[model samples]
Target: MSPASTAAASAGPSARRQASGPAFALTAGVIGLCLAASAVPSPLYRLYAVRWHLPTSTVTLIYATYCLGVLASLLVFGRVSDTWGRRPVVMTGLSGLLVAMGLFGFASGAAWLFAARAVQGLATGIAISASGAALLELRQGRDPATASLANVVASALGVGAGGLLGAVLLQFAPAPLVTPFVVLAVLVAVLLLGMTTVPETVPRVSRSGLRIATPGVPRQIRAPFVVAGLAITCAWSIIGIYLGLAGTLAPALLHTASPLAAGLAILALGGASAVPPLVARALPPAVQIVWGTLALIGGIASMAWSLSADSAVLFVAASVVIGIGVGFAMFGALRTVGAAAPPDGRARVMAAFYIVAYAAISLPAVAAGFVAQRLGAEATFQIFGAGIVAVSVGTLLPALARHRAQHRAQHRA
Candidate 1:
C-alpha cells in the first residue's frame, strides 16, 4: 500500500461514524449473497431448456445475455456508490435482485427467464461493486487487505455453495425451477432488510448524486492497475474454462455420468479456491500474484497431460492446485488494485476490476464452448489448457520481475 492509502485507511475508522461489527460482517455477506445468487441459476438452465424445448444454442445465448447485463451495469453504475454513498446503492441493487428472483419464480416462458437473468446480472454487478468498496472503508484496524481477502474468499465459497445448493434443490424440489429462485428471493429480501442497519461508508464530502460514469482505472493507479488486470485475467480465465468444462469433463474425461459427481467437482473447486487467501493473508499482494500465476501455469500443464492420458486423478489434482492459485492470485490482485485506488473513486475502480473479471468469465467460457463443439470436450480441454499455459507464462514473467524488484528494494532498505 502507498503511504497515502495506508494512512487514510488507518485514519478512516476514527473519522467516520462507527459501524456495528455485525453490520460490517453483513457487508461481506452481501458479496457472498450476490455471487451465490449468480451461481444458483446455472442448475436451472437445463430445466429451462427442457421445459421450454429450447436448443443448446439458445440456452447459451440466454446465458450470454446475463453476462452482457453485468458488464453494462458495471459500466454505467460502477461509480454511483462513490457519488451517492454506498448504502443506498447497495439497497437499490439488492431490491432489484429481489425483483429478479420474483421473475424467476413466476416465469412462464424463456422470455421471462431472459428478463430475470438480465436483472439479476445487473443487480449483482452494482451490489457487489459497492459492497466491495464499502468493505475497504469498513475495514477495522490497520490492514487494508482484509476486505480484498474477504472479497476473494467469499466469492469462491459462494459459487461452490450456491451451485451445490441449486443442484440439490433441482434434484429434490417439487417445482425445481421455481423453488431455487424462491429460496434466493428469501435470502435477497433478508439481505435487503439487513442493509438498513449498515453505516454508509461514502463520506459526506464525496456525495455528488448519481452520475453514469464508465468504469475506469484512474491515471494515479495505472501501474498496479495494469498488473491487477493481467493477474485477474489469468486467474479468472482459468476458472471460467474449468467451470465451462467441469461438468462435461465429469462425463467425458472423468468417466462419470452422474450429475451429483459433476456438482461435487465444482464444490471442490470452490472449496480449494477459498483456502489460499486465508493462508497468504500476511504476504504482499505482488508475491501472491506471482505465486498464483505459477500455480496456474503448472495446473494447465497437468490438466493437458491428464486429458492426453485420460487420467481422472491427475485432472482432479490439477483442479485443486489451480483453485488454490486462483485464491492467492485474485486476492492479491484485488488487494493491490483496491489499495491503489483513491478513496473517493474506490467504487469506480472496483467496478473496473469486476468488469475485467466478469469479461474473463464470459469470454473464455464462450470460446471454450466453441472448442467443445468443434474439437470434442477432451480436445477442448487440452487446447484451452495449453493456450492458458502460454498466456500464464506471459503474465508470470512480468509479475516475477516485479516481485524480485520489490524484494531487492526491501532488502536494501
Candidate 2:
C-alpha cells in the first residue's frame, strides 16, 4: 500500500479505540446546538428590519454574510482538525460561538449583526467539520450511516428550535433580540463543558503551518460527484431563500406583525426537513434525488403562487413541502458522495461538496436580495421559484436517465 493509504488505515483503528458512546453523543449535541444558534436570528431578521429601518436588501445581505463566513472557513480550515486533532478545534469553535452570542446580545445596530453573524458562521463551520469527523470515528462498530443521520437530524432540529425560540422570546420576553442570544450563550456554555469530557479522535500530526488546499475528487467518481454537488447546491439555495426571506415574506403576505406566525413558518420548514430522512432512509439515492427534486419544484411553485395571491396558509404549506424536499435531496446527495469517495479522501470530498453548497447558499440570496430591491418581494419570489425549478429539473433528468440505463442493462444481463 502507498504511505498515505497505510497512514489512513493505521489511523482508523486508533480512532475507533478512542470512541466512547457518551463522547459521541456530546459531540453530536454540540453540532446541533451550533446549527440551532445559527438559525436563532432567522425569525428575528424582520424585527431588525423594522427596528433599524433596514431595507429588504440589507436584511438579505446580513443573512448572506453568514454563508460567506461558512464558505471561507470550509475552504481554509475544513481539514485542519484532521491534522491538529478534533478536540482543540472544536473547543475553539465553541469559544467563538460564545463570543458571537455575546455580540448578538449586545448589538445596537446593523454593524453588530453583521459581525456577530460572521463570527457565528465561522464558529459553526469549524465545529461541524470537527464534530462530524468525530462522529464517524466514534461510530462504535455501528455503520457510519448512523453518524450521517444524527448530523442531519441535529441540524434540522437546531434550525427549527432556534427560529421557534426566537419567536417565543420576541413574543414574551422584555428584550426580544437580547434574550435569545443570552439563552444561546447559556446552552453553549453547557455544551462546552460537555465537550471537555470528549476524547480526541485525531492524533496530532506535525505540519509546517495551515495551508490553503482545494479539495479534489478522483476521476472515477467525478460523475456522481457532479450530480451530488449540483443537487446539494440546488437544495441549499432553496433553503437559503427560506431562511433569508421567509420571515420577511410571511409577515408581508399575511399582512400581520405577528412574530409567532413568522417563526412558525420557519419552524415548519425546519421540522419538515427532518422528517424525510427518517421516513425515506431506505430509498435508493437516485429515487431520493428524483422525488426530492419533484417535491422541491412543487413547493417552490406553490410558494410563488402563495406570494402572488397573498395566501399565508398556502405559504406555510409550501414551506413544509420545501423542507421535506430539502431533507431528502440533501440526505441522498451526501450518501451518494460518501459512497463514491475514497476512504482516505472522504474529508476532502466532503469539504469540496460544502464549498460548492455554501457558495450556492450565499450567492443566490444576494442576487435575490438585489432583485427584491427592484421588483419587490412578490416578483422576486416568482423569479427565484422558477429558477429553482429549472435547476431541479436540470439535475433530475440525468440522474433518472442514468438509473434507467443501469436498470435496463441489469435486466438484459
Candidate 3:
C-alpha cells in the first residue's frame, strides 16, 4: 500500500486510542472559553450601566436577551450536527462567537449591549451542541466512562473559570470593560483557526425523504437521562443565578461596591469548585453523585445564610463548596447519559439533555430577577436556596435507587 493508503488503513483503530486525549483537551478548551465569554460581559455590565447612564434593570434586560438568543438558536440548529457533521457546525459556532466578541468594542449604549449579548448567545448556542457532539464522537476507548467524565468536568471548569477569570480580569486588569472581551476575541480567533484541524466525527448524511419527525430518545436510556439532567440542571442553575449578578449583589449586601472584591466572590465560586473533580478522579461515579449532592445542599444552604445575614465571606465560602458539589454530581451524571446512549442517537439525546439544562439556566435567573425586583437580593437568594434543596432531593432519590439496584445486580452476577 502507498503511504497515504497505509495511513488511512491504520487510522481507524489508532485514532480511537488517541481519541480521549485530543477530544478531551479540545472540548475542554472550547467549552471553557465559551463559558468565559458568557461571563466576560457580566462585570462589564456595571460599567455599561454607569457609562451609558442606564438603570440596573436595563442591564438585566440586556442579559436576558442573550439568553433568549441562545435558547432560540438551540431550538433551531442544536441538532444540525447530527446530519451536517461536527466540523462545519462547530466552526460556524466559533465564527458567531468571534463576531459577538468584536461587537463589544462598539457597545456604548443599551442597544449596543443588547446586540452584542444576542450575538454572543447565538454563538454559544451553536458551539455548545457541536462541541458536545464532537466530544461524544471522539471517544476512542472500549469504555467511554473516562471520556464522558472529562467532558462534564471540563464544561463545569470552563464555566467556573470563565466567571472567576472574567471577574479577575475586570477588577485587576487595566480596561475593566474593554480588555476582557478583546482578549477573549483574540483567543477565540486562535481557537477558530485551531478548530480547522479537528477531525470531523460525524459524517454528512442526506436529510431529504426522511419523515420529518422529532427523534425519540431510546427507551433504555430514559432513566439515566433523567439522572443526568437533574445533576446538570441543579448545578448550572446555581451558577446562572449567582454568577449572573454576584458582582452587583455582593457590593450592595457588603456596603461596598468594590469591583475587585465582588469579582473575587465570583472567582471563589469557580476556584473552590475546581478542586473536587481532580480529587474525585479515582472515585466511583455513584459515590461522587451522593457526596456531591450533599456538598451542593450544604453549599446552597450556607450561601442562603450568607445572604440572609449579609456576609460576603460566608457567601464566598458557600459558593466554593457548591461549585465542588456541582463538579462531582454534574460530571457523574453527564458521563452516565453519554455512556448509556447508542452512538447513532448520541447527538439527539445530548441535544435533548441540553434543552433541559439550558432551561435550568434561563428560567431560574428570570425568577431571581423578578424576586430581586419585588423583595430584594437577600430574599431572592433565600428563595433560590429553597428551590435548590427541593430540586436536589428530587434528583437524588432516583439516582440512589439506580445506584443501589446496579450494585445488587453486580453482587448477584
Candidate 4:
C-alpha cells in the first residue's frame, strides 16, 4: 500500500468508532435544543398580537427583529466558534436563549417582543455555526454522510418541534404565552448543564498567534459560492415565508384562523423536510440541488393553488413540497460549499451564505406582510408565491443549460 493509505489504515477503527458514541449524541442534543428555542416563538406571535392588539405587519417586524439580532451576532462573532472553540460559544448561545425565553414569557409590549426576538436571534446565530462546525469536527474520519444527515435531521426536528411544542403548550397550558417560554427556559437550562458532559470538539489555542478576522472566499471558489448562495437563498426563502408568516396567514388563507392550526402549517413543512435526507443518503451535491429546485417549484405552485382555491389540504401539501426542497437544497449547499471551500476562506464564504439565507427568511416575508395590508392578503400571498417561483425557476434554467452544455462538450471530446 502507499504510505498515505497505510497510515490511514493504521489509525485504527477503534479510535474512529469512539467519536460516534455518547459524547456525539450529547453534543447533537445540545445544538438541536438551541435551535429549537430559536423557533419556539414562531407559533406565539398570534398570541402576542391578540394580547397587544397589534397588527400582523407588526408581528412581521417583530420577527424581523430576530433576524437583526442573528445578523449582528453573526457579524460580530460568527467566527468565534472557530477561534474560541465550539463548546464554550454554544454554551454562551444557550444562555442567551434562556434569558431571551424568560423575557419573552413575561413580554407585555412591542419592546419586550423585540428584545426577546433579538436575544433569540443572537442565541441562534451563535449556536448554529458552532453546532454545525462541531458536528463536522466530531464526525471527522467517520461517515461524512452520517454526520451531514444527523445535522440536517436535527435541524429539521428542532425547528418542527419548536412550533408543535409551542402550539401544544399554548393550546393546553394555563397562561399559554407565559408558560411555553418558562418551559423552554427550563429545558435550555437542562441542555446547558448537559454541555459539561461532551468533550470539546474544537480545541483551544488553534490560532497559534494568528489574529482571527471575518471569513472570506478564495478566488477559485467564487463561482460555486455565487451559485450556492443563490440556490440557498431561493430555497430558504420558502421557509422564510412559511415559518415567519404562516401563523398569521394560514388562518386567514385557509379560513381556519386558529393559532394552533396555523402553527401546524409551519410544522408540517418542518416535519416533512426532515424525512427526505434519511432516504437520500449519499446523494451528490449537484443532484440534490436539482431535486431541490424542482421541489421548490412544485411546493410554491401548490401553495399558490391552495390560496387561489382556498383549500387547506392543498396548503398542507404545499408545505410538504417546500419542506422537501429546503431539506435537499440546504444539505446540498452545505456539502458543496464545504467541499469547494479552501480552508483559508471557508469562514467568510459561509458567513456570506448565511447572510443571504437569513435575508431570504426575513426581508421578503416582511415585505409580504406590508403588501398584504395594502393589496389584500390573498393577492399579497399570490405575489409572494409567484415571485419565489420565478426566482427558483430563473435559478434552475441557467444552471441546467450550463450543466447540459458541459456534458455535451465532454461527450463531443
Predicted model with the maximum TM-score: 1
* Residue 154 shift from truth in candidate 3, angstroms: 2.7
Better of 1 and 3 by TM-score: 1
Tens digits of lDDT, candidate 1, 1-413: 54545445432443334533777678888898888887776666666877889876666667777788888999999998988888899999999999999998999988998898899889988898999888887763345677787888888988788877787887778898889888888888888888898877765665889788887888978878888888898888887777667767755666755555556667777888899888878888888888888988887788888878888888788878888888888988888887788766788899999999899888877777766777877788787777777777787777777778878999999
True lDDT of residue 133, candidate 1: 86
Query: Candidate 2: where are CA atoms >4 Å away?
Result: 1-20, 203-212, 401-413
Evaluate model 3: give its lDDT. 0.72
State each candidate's clash count: 0, 0, 0, 3
How would the candidate models be sorted by lDDT, starting from the highest? 1, 2, 4, 3
lDDT of 4: 0.72
lDDT of 3 by residue, 21-131 (tens): 664577657877887788767666777777889876787778788888877777777777666666677778889988887788666668877888899888887788667
CA shift of 321, model 1, Å: 1.1
In candidate 4, what are the lDDT values of residues 106-181, reduced to their tens digit?
7889999999998889987777766666655555544655655676677777778888888888888899989888
- Model 2, 54-153: lDDT tens digits are 8877777787778888878777878776656677778888999999999999999999989998998898777777686666656534455566667677
- What TM-score would you give candidate 4 relative to the actual structure? 0.88
lDDT of 1 at 220: 74
With a 3 Å backbone cut-off (N, CA, C), the pairs that clash in candidate 4 are 215-348, 216-348, 251-257
Best by lDDT: 1
Whole-structure CA lDDT of model 1: 0.80
Rank all candidate structures by their TM-score, best first, as comma-separated numbers. 1, 3, 2, 4
Alpha carbon lDDT of residue 356, candidate 2? 81
Alpha-carbon local distance difference test for all models = 0.80, 0.78, 0.72, 0.72
